[model samples]
Target chain A: MPAIDLSTTPLRELNQSLHALAEGNNETEWEVLNPDGRHAVAVGIDAPVSVDIRGPVGYYCGGMNKQATVTVHGSAGPGVAENMMSGKVVIKGDVSQYAGATGRGGMLVVEGNAASRCGISMKGIDIVVKGSIGHMSAFMAQTGNLVVLGDAGDALGDSIYEARLFVRGNVQSLGADCVEKEMRDEHLELLEDLLQRSGITGVKPSEFRRYGSARKLYNFNIDNADAY
Target chain B: MCGIVGLFLKNEALEPQLGALTSAMLATMCERGPDSAGFAVYGQSLDGEAKITLQSSSPEIDFPALAKALENEIAGAVKLTQRATHAVLTCRRDELDTIRAAVRRLAPSVRVMGVGEAIEIYKEVGYPTAVSERFELKGMKGTHAIGHTRMATESAVTTLGAHPFSTGPDQCLVHNGSLSNHNNLRRSLAHDGIQLETQNDSEVAAAYLTWRMKQGLDLGQALEKSLDDLDGFFTFVVGTKNGFGVLRDPIACKPAVLAETDDYVAFGSEYRALVGLPGIDTAKVWEPEPATVYFWER
Candidate 1:
């Protein structure tokens, strides 16, 4: 176990150390102290290590992560876990805008509420928010599942694609080409798995309503060939 | 990009540390806006006393004579505290306009930064820390303060282009985004008899709020109306005599974080600016929503 205090050591040093880890490095568990809302903490890590950040972080924490788990004891600023691949990230407190945005693969969980564009243009990632999400969430998302246990703000899943949205509470309004769809048993199982992974309880998967693209914006037809 | 930081104190005990706290907060945001910085401090007001903050390109020549001329013309006791290139002239409250006119007459090169009973504005085309240090902001005492660091997106890098733009007495605003409709809005505001000192877009926003307030709207109402009238991305932190407010445009591309406790309310473009505050670890921190207004008054 290793501990890095960001207030004393430069943030780049901590991130560089994390990036320099060799295969099967003995120092697998790391603790970050006094993050103090700085930007780009623990970013671009490819090791299978667990980094526990003890305080709030600024922009783009845990960005482009791979094969690691990063947990923030406090809230995260914008772009937390952005472009993460094959890793787990958890924010125990509220997150700023674009949390887990454009993630290629990985599971990100926000125990607290998220600001707008929580998963804008997300690709092949799964995000579970224990609380509500803000407007324009999952906008034009090409892949992944976004589960919001609490209410969603205006324009939820606007112009979305392929991504599955499950909200137990109200949806202010759907985005263009985004409409409510039937929740099949497969969707229920998927939602259940995401909830269990996020350690969510006291909420049933059956309580959610699903939303997805209407297949009108991008889909083409022979009759409309001339329009292109 | 630009940075805006504001602190409104609820407890009197924390007032003495207001400037130091705000300066630290502003310094943390230097990366967001490195070209210039400005801040407005709302100090404790006395009976019928107002101050006008003035800045000049050549303070050595403009400030001393201007202070003496103002003292004689106003026929009242005048105190001029000089910083690097700025000065605060404390005088009789009713004579604010008279002194403003006198200073313009006495020193043609001097620019009145802001005028109010409690507000003292200082802005410069420099880094945030040096600007704060030159003004001795760490030693100043105030009840609340709003600060801005500018990156010079839509305007040139000059003292006037720096933020914490003042348009009305005891009112100031710091903005973090650009306005697309400023040229059009500036014309409309000018047509309505509102004068602006700078071609900076943020000043137009300040004038708009001043115009709204003149129409009998409070700070909160004025900010709400701005959501519809002002076009473009912005996260504005506004300061009045007794209160400070925060408003973000509906598109909300700009970021704003707010933290509140029993002692004070704080606003930062990002949470990083607030880490140095006392008891901040336990403060209730959250990002302000888009198209919303959050204000605090002592």
Candidate 2:
């Protein structure tokens, strides 16, 4: 295990050293100390390593990650795990806006609340938030599963496409072309697996409400001109 | 992007450190908005007296004769405390309007930053640390203060365009996001006899609140009205003589974090600004809900 003190080592050098490591190397475990709310830490890693950041990080931590596991002990700034392809990113504390934005694959878990646009344009990633999320959490989401154990803010899934949303608590409002749909057994089974994968317990899948696109705005229609 | 920070002290012991704490918070936000910065402090107030904060490009020439000329014009005693490029003019409450008019007539180049019994504003076109140092903000004492770092999206990077815009007496507003309908609202507000100072969209927001307050609406009511009437993405932190308010638009595209403890209520564009405050780790931290008004008054 390698321990890097961010107070003495620049973030760029640490990231560069992490990026230079070969896959499946013995030096796979790393620790980042004294993050101090700096942006873009542990970004663009393509290795199967594990990095634990001791303190709060600024924007875009673990962005575009592949096969790496990054965890933050403190809160995260905006865009945590943004555009991640394949890996696991975890925030022990709260996260700011656009968490897991545009992620294609991998799992992002937030122990605390996630701010606005938590999974905006998410393309096949899975995000599970133990706390509430802010407005427009999954705007224009093409595919993925966004599970919120707590309440959601306004416009939960506006302009969404194909993505699935599960909220155990109240939703402030639904977004354009996004609406609550009936949760059948298959959806419940899917949510159950997601809840298990995210290590969420004590709540059954039956308690969650599913939201997705209405499909009315999927194609151009003359009657939909007024809504547009 | 722009950054906004506010500190409202509930404990009297922390009053002396208001400016220092707020300066630290503002410094953390320099990356969000590096163009310019401004701040307004609410200090001790005197009965029957008003404090007018003024800024001059040529402080050596305009500020020296300002206090004496304004005292003569208003027929009252005036005291001037000059910083690098700003000054606070204290005069009789009844003579505030007359003194402001006299200063405008005496020196058109001088801009009035704010006017109130307890508020003094200092701002300039520089980095947050530089502006705070120029005004000696760390040494000031106050009950509450609000600061802004501007990114200059809608307007030029002039001193006048700097934030903490004060259009009404003792009332100033700092906003993070741009308003879409500000030009139309500015015209309507101007038609309603509200005098606007700059083309900056944020000044219109301040004037709008002032106009609402003048119409017998309290701060909370004015903020509620703003949710319905004001169109745009905004997270506004407003300062009054005795009140500090935070409001965000319905969409809440802009970010705002709030933390409150037994000693103080603090607001920042991000949590990092609040991390350095005393007892922040134990404070009740949360994100402000959209279309909601949170205010604290002494």
Candidate 3:
């Protein structure tokens, strides 16, 4: 394992060294020390490496990540793991606004609560939050799975599109075009796999209530104009 | 894109380090708002005594005889302390009105920064770190302090346009976003006998809160009322004589993080600003919710 202390070294140097990693390189495991709430740590990585950050990080911690497993031991600021293509990012503590925003392909696991706008505009991302989520989560989402273990705040999945939302706890209110939907065996099996992969046990898949887009705002029309 | 930081020390043991901690917190947000910066420190209040912070372009010329001029009219021995381009005049609480009138006549260019028994305001049109150094912020001791760095989207980058706007005695406000209805609010506030000093939207926000508080509203009630009356996206960090408060607008696009330990309560626009605080690793840190009032009082 190669260890880098960010307090004494420039963040650009660390990022540059990581970006320079080749496919066949032996330096596969990396440890980042003293992140100290710095912005854009471990961003834009394309290699299949494992990075363990030791402390809390500021905005956009694993942005645009691909083929990497980046784990933050502490909380994260806004836009964490934003716009990821392919990767696995895990936050051990709470996260601020818009965690995993606009991600195209990835799996994001948050062990703590998430603030507002979680997974906004997501595309094909699998997000699992062990704790509650704030308002307006999964807004305008397309092709994703959001699993929340605790109570969700107001306006969950507002103006959503083609996303499967599974909430085990209470949802304060649904958004304009979001409504409760039936959870078939396929959804139960998918949620089971997601829960098992995320190391979540003891919670049955049947406990969750599913929500999705009402599909009324898919096209512009005069009758359903208010929903649009 | 302004940055705001506030610290309220619950542990009196950390009271002496309030200025250093707040200055460091503001320094981390320099990139967010580089146009100008300002701060207000709420320190201990002396019985029957109050002070007013004044600023001028030429402190060397205006601050020299200000003490004697105020003492002659106010019938008390005025204490003056000058730092960079700003000065503080301390005297009997009831005689401040006379001193204000005398300072206007004696030093025509001096502008009052803030007036309170326990608050002193300092501001300059420069980077936050450099302005903090000019104000000797690291040397001051206080129970609580709030600071602001302005990006100047809605107003020009002048000393008055800088934040920590003090519209009420022992109360100051620092903002992180622009107000949309400040012009109309300014007109109505003027109709209600509240005069604002600048076209800056943040000053209007401060004056509005002060006006609401004057209408028999507490700080928390005034903030809750503001959610309905004020039109804007704002994350405000407010400082009162014995309290520190934070409020985010309904949409809450402007970010704000708050941390509370056994020793202190701290507010920062970003998590980076709070990383340097003591015991922050174990502190209960979280983002302030939208349209919520979080207040800590002594």
lDDT of 2 by residue, B1-298 (tens): 9999999999999999998899999999998899999999999999999999988887466675778888778777999999999999998899989998998899888888999999999889999889999899999899999999989998999999999999898999999999999999999998999988788999999999999999998888898899988998899999888898999997787888899999999998887788789998788887887888998877
Instruction: Report the C-alpha lDDT of model 2 over A93-121, residue by residue, as the tens digit.
Output: 99999999999999999999998899999
RMSD of each: 1.4, 2.2, 1.5
lDDT of 3 by residue, B248-288 (tens): 99889899999999899999999889988999989999888
Candidate 1: RMSD over Cα atoms? 1.4
Clashing pairs in 2: none
The model with the greater TM-score, 1 or 2, is 1
Per-residue lDDT tens digits of candidate 1, residues B125-189? 99999999999999889899999999998888999989899999999999988899999999999
Ranking by DockQ: 1, 3, 2
TM-score order of candidates, best first? 1, 3, 2
lDDT of 3 by residue, A1-228 (tens): 989999998999888988999998899899999999999999999999999999999999999999999999999999999998887999999999999999998899999999999999999989999999999999999878999999888899998999899999999999989999999999999999999988899999999999999998766779866865
Ten-residue segment with the worst summed lDDT in candidate 3 chain B? B57-66
First chain of model 3: TM-score? 0.97
